[model samples]
Target: MKKIILSASLAFILFTNLKADAQIKLSDIFKKVTEKQSTTSTTGTPSSLEIGQGIKEALQLGVSAGADRLSAKDGFLGNLAVKILMPPEAQKVEKTLRSIGLNSLCDNVIVSLNRAAEDAAKEAKPIFISAIKQMTLADASNILLGNNDAATSYFKRVTTAQLLQKFSPIVTNSLSKVNASKYYSDLTTQYNRLPLVKPVSTDLTGYVTQKAIDGLFIEVAKEELKIRGNINSRSTTLLQKVFGYADKKKG
Candidate 1:
């Protein structure tokens, strides 16, 4: 009886231990499955969201860097891609005045106009950064999926009016500082002195503002194209991957 009871008790203990071990293994499997499900649920939808965000961040940084590059001392003067040229409307006055032997003054006015544009570009960096920070997921996705210059176009569309308003005063001040006003006045005096010519009048500030904005967009487009076409220009891994996807779509 003692042997029988002892054997029965040993069997019971072994069976209980085996059952406990099996339960632990089952619990571990359930934990792994639950963890995987949670991870999948959390990550699946948000990955696309993150990709869109990353592209926008890349574009914004690219614009800021590009603007900074252009705002330096030789930014406008050095970069042929973005150098400000005289407006066509003002060309007639410049040509007529030069024809009347006031070529030096005409040259001065043209140079001063470009100088004012360069000075006004200094103000654009901060404004552009502000606009960049305001970009949304929808905006990002659109920019990513759109044409090469789409990001720049979106910036121009949203910020051009506000930028114009902000730029006018700065351009006016720059023009005055650069003696553009005096140059314009001298040119106008020479132009009006021309016999049988209509009075040569133009809004120096407004024209400079518009021209400066146009030049900035040109630079932005150049940067955008670089980022799209040149792998080296895409600084970050995310940018490379995202834009690489774009390149594949184009292909």
Candidate 2:
């Protein structure tokens, strides 16, 4: 009877050990499956933050490149799209002055306006970079999803007021330094000498400031359009992919 009890006890102990080992094996398999699932999830897609950051980086790069192009020699002069043209209000005066043999002074005024624009554009790079850096997720989304000039428009909207404040004075100083005021004075004197037309006075600084801003926006729009339409202009896989998504949505 005692020998029989001993054998039964051994069998029970063996069964318990087997059951424990099986449970441990099953737990290990479950852990491995959980770990694999976690790895897949992590690798499968980017987080929202990551996506936002990528968009911001693309915008910043675009802005930097675009601004650099604008600041280069003959950048505005070479690009007809953004070339500084005579203001409509001043055009009449310009023509009248030129017709009366003040052509040299008219040319000087035009050249000085463009020069002021060029000088003020130098200050735009930092402002543009700062604005790009401050881009929020909403801003990024709008830029990514809006029209071809959306990004340019966004920058214009956000930076215009501040840019004008910062740029106007510089433009004023540039014009004065380049003797634009004298040229205008000479032209106006010539115009006033005309008996048919009334003596007209205008603010050279304000007119030039507005024109400079307009020219900058025109160039930025061109850059934005290039990026939107030309894959080669993207310059990066992220830009291509993000803008590709935007194009797809449009189509």
Instruction: Give the alpha carbon lDDT tens digit for every residue of 35-147 in model 2.
Output: 88765542333445544665677666676666676667666656676666566766788887777687888878877777777788888878888887888878787777787
Model 2 regions lying over 4 Å from their true place:
1-47
Flag regions of model 1 displaced more than 4 Å.
1-46
Every model's TM-score: 0.76, 0.76
lDDT of 1: 0.77
Question: Which run of 10 residues does model 2 get worst, by summed lDDT?
Answer: 41-50
Supply candidate 2's per-residue lDDT for 151.
83
User: What overall lDDT goes with each candidate model?
Assistant: 0.77, 0.76
Model 1 C-alpha lDDT per residue in residues 1-251, reported as the tens digit of each score: 99999999999999999999999999999999998875554222234666576666676777777767766776776777666655666678877766768788876776777777777778887787777778777877778778888888987998899879988998899889889899888777876787897886788898889888887888778878888888888776567667776676668
